[model samples]
Target: MLEKRFKLSANNTTVKTEILAGLTTFMTMAYIIALNPNILTNYGAGGAELWNGVFLATCLSSAVAMFVMAFLANKPFCLAPGMGLNSFMAIVIGQLVATTGMGYVQSFQSMLCIILIEGVVFLILSLLNVREKIVDAIPLGIRLGISPAIGLMLLNIGFGSNVYIADSNFNQFFVMKDFFGALTASHARDVMTDAYPVMVLSAITMFVGLFVIVVLASKGVKGAVIIGMLAASVLYWVCDAVFLGSNPFASLATASFVPAFGDMASTTLFKFNFAGLAQMGWFTAVTLVITFCIIDMFDTIGTLVGTASRAGMVDREGNMPNMKEALLSDSVGTIVGSCTGTSTVTTFIESASGVEAGGRTGLTALTCGIAFLLCIFLAPIAAIIPAAATSAALIYVGVLMMTGLKKVNFDDLSVCVPVTIMLIGMPISGSIGHGIGLAMISYTIIKVFTGKAKEVSGLTYVISVLFLIKFFLAV
Candidate 1:
């Protein structure tokens, strides 16, 4: 039954088939159970119980969000805790605390409050049609560049599952630390001495999975990526259990449809540090909320628009009708995530993978959503998913996301400069808004200086001026 269901394609899929496809989408995204917890813990906010709560909250919020996006919004996209925003909440907020002497929990509460406010703000803008207008205000070149940059950012984080960070003079990165960590740590030593046997195993899983997909796809295989990866992961586990006498990593393996009650009931939600927000002042809260709202809006819209374009989900009007639902559902997810004791819940660009794998309609999202709900009980088994294994998927998706670059007009300096700035700024600046803001400011300067200012939108000019003032004058 599973195989038959998995063998359906988005282009030819019925509602039933799309639902089945969504299940595979859920499996592919299941890593978030661990990933979200790990990221949020950096803020002094998580433990096993916290992780459980986050998993539950994430599941519930996402399920609700997806339902809206799927059944309510009627769009074929999936929503989850966004990748980049969590990092900001985890790391950037930590910095804010250090500089401000705010308690971590208090700061966390403040941030959550900020997120809630951002959601409300987004809801208002969306309703007023202001959000869409702002999005339209962005330059075509800079707008075109955001998607691939997001993909790159996602690919970078995805690589971390395999590579550990180490201190370095040159803004330390993955390479050197991974090299040394392999020799020093016992587990690293064990994996390395064994020539990354698990990684090798995961590689095989990925290879075999890709092969199956390619072959099945040729034979009209639907859900090829999902079927291939699952088969490979299972094979990887079986080999480990048989040869090693146990699968140490099996605990973290992604599972489909196993709901976790314990995680949900105990999850920390609505536990706001009103006192903390007070200390930060209404100004800070408002600033943070504005920042978050702007970032989340661009981030979510970019993901949805890019994903929809790829999946051919765009309408004849060049607009996806249910985007309003996607935005609303995402805001609700953020509120739920805060109440549940985790990072902000936003749409994931990674859902594009499921769409590419024959996911269309709400069925695919529903399947993925159901799979996420099931993951709460499977927490203990998450270790089974190797970083290297997931990295392959990330890299694959990155390759796909990069395809958006074809739309950029490199020949036009007006377009090329801003696009180039965005590409460089996102990863280096470590903030999507920074990358985009710089691009906008630079684009505005270049166009105005070049006498092509008339082509830019009035709002774009106003926003670009604000970016300059906020970044230079205010900061």
Candidate 2:
């Protein structure tokens, strides 16, 4: 039944392979389950009930989107309340509170209304094939650059932001950018205090896990990512127990296994405050909605194109099959997220981990969706996997994706400059959409001034102008 549904043989994959790939993808991106609620609830200022609500919403909405991607689009990508979008949603909530004199909970519900409108806009665009046209509008040069750009972004996450050590005051120290980049070990020690040694352990664990996966992959081993992650997780556990004098599984003793369905039901489920939304004024609401739409549309498009390219799912012209279905699934995710209470749900770049693990069909997505549903009851178990372990998978996947740069035509200044900008922009800006936006603007400017204005497509021109306005002119 599974094979017939997912066409496993047609995609040259087995049930085992797809399932393992799905697990790999889940392990890599599961941070969202805990982090989304924390960010959206403003570190509990919105109350514990709100936190629990967003937590279930994150799990439920992500599962819904992944299921849609599986059955409707047959894509391996997973969806979640996106990291950046959630942060922006939090900001918008804060602003709405300040400007409209609404309470935080009221403002949050109003923002959900905004998210619902944004999702409806995306659904309309996707069903009308406008989203597919936007994808098609990206130049071949810029399209080919997406994978390598996303690779750099992964490296940024893996090494720069993946693992952090907290001080006594709860200040974060990034292992790579803070510890190793410190003037000296003593300087790092002074800043991180008792947390410095944990940073060292993370560095060692990350490299060990990365090397393990690399060696296994070199030997053509299947499930190398999961194996490496398991090995690294065990190592982290031992180190924490023996050296840090802490029990890694101690949290499992007191962690709640309940789904918090009641919190979601009362706090966030179908809680759209249209009165508060109207109080925010139409201009503020419209501007925020447009911003959300532009950022989310391109972010999803970039992740799909980039990861699909890395997985060899794109054709010669850099277009993926089932593009419309995929975009529509993303819209569905956001709509469901608003109703359930979370940020915009979009495709995650971490899906590349699964693709690299040999996932080739909807079975992989189905498996991931099931895991997300399971997380509602087993969040604690997933949380103990150790951030260092997933860092290894991301770094390894990034290294592999960087190989796509060989296909770029560096001799062409137009392609080289835009691709180069995008490659750097993704990591620095921490936004796939912003990176692609810069690439488009650069590509369009180069072509227009070089007597090649006629070569640029009409939609590309319009998108370039839109991004330009988004970057500098939008209120």
Candidate 3:
């Protein structure tokens, strides 16, 4: 039954291979289980109750989304509350709390309302095939560039040096001179001396693991990324135990091994603030909803296409099988995630790990979903894996994603120019939307100047202008 349903043999894969691939993918991306709540809890100001609620929501929503992708889409993909989206939600909540004089809880609830609205909008778009049309509207040049641009973005994130300074008003890039100066003055000394031993050791650990993974993968070692991450985590734990005398299992003792079901079921479950939404003003609410929808839409499209390309799931014409089902699953995940008290959930690029590991069936997604469900009881253990370990996986994946650059056509300046701009802008701007917007605007301008404006689609022009208004005019 499983063979007929998933077509495992047709894809040249076995159930054992699919299970291994799924486990490998889960190990690489499991850090999100702890990291999501850490980001959403706003440094504990949301209190233990809210923190626990978000943590449970992250796990449950992710599991549900993966299952949907497995059964409906029959693809080895996973979904989670996206990293950039969650950070944006945090910034928006902070703004509302400060400007409207609303408490943190109220502001958070208002943010949830925006996410819910965005999710519903996504559902409508997906059902009507509007999202797929938008994807089709994007020029082949830009579509090809999107993957490499996302690769650069992931690389920047993995390095942990792309700094964005957040103030009371908004987040902005740190001054380049000041940022470089600080890197040289403090970071240089900290790496050489005992002043920040942990920082130095963390860097070393990450690089060593990355090197190991790269070498092993080159030799066709199966699960090399997961093995390297686990090894690096063990090294970090040993260092902490010896140097800092910290108890690795202290959190487990404090929180207990059982899932916090009672707290999760009561607090922040389906807690939308429609009245608070009205208080935020219709304009602000609408703007927030649009922003969420745009970011989530492009991010999902880029990731799905890029990862599918890597997995050999896309045909020569760039059409992916069961793409509508895959897209609908993403939409459903966002709606489920929002109602459960989190940010917009979308398809994760980390699913590429499973693809790399020879995952070719929905059974892989099912295995990953089961792993996320198990995390509800193993949260404490999951929390202990340091960022350094997973950073290696991200960097490795980024390296793999750069293969998309081979498909780009550099013979024409109009195509090459936008692709180049997008490739550089993504990492520097720290936004996939910003990079894509720049590419579109540049493409349109170049086409118009070169007497080929008709080459661009109508929807492309409309989206470019919209992005310009949003990013530059702050509308």
Winning candidate number (TM-score): 2
Model 1 per-residue lDDT at 255? 47
Q: How close is candidate 2 to the true structure, as a TM-score?
A: 0.99
Candidate 3: 10-residue stretch with minimal lDDT = 171-180
Between candidates 2 and 3, which one is better according to TM-score?
A: 2
Q: Ranking by TM-score, best first?
A: 2, 3, 1
Question: After aligning candidate 2 to the native by TM-score, how far in Å is the CA of 364 from where it should be?
Answer: 1.0
lDDT of the candidates, in the order given:
0.65, 0.93, 0.79
Tens digits of lDDT, candidate 3, 23-62: 8678767877877877877967877777788888898888
Q: Ranking under lDDT, best-scoring first?
A: 2, 3, 1
RMSD list, candidates in order: 5.5, 0.9, 4.0
Task: Return the lDDT, model 1, position 353.
Answer: 66
Misplaced by over 4 Å in model 2 are none
Each model's total of backbone clashes: 25, 0, 0
C-alpha TM-scores of all predictions: 0.80, 0.99, 0.90
Give the lDDT of residue 342 in candidate 3. Answer: 83
Q: Score residue 83 of candidate 2 by CA lDDT.
A: 81
lDDT per residue (tens digit) for residues 195-251 in model 1 = 444444555555565566566657877666666666667776787788656655643
lDDT of residue 100 for candidate 1: 70
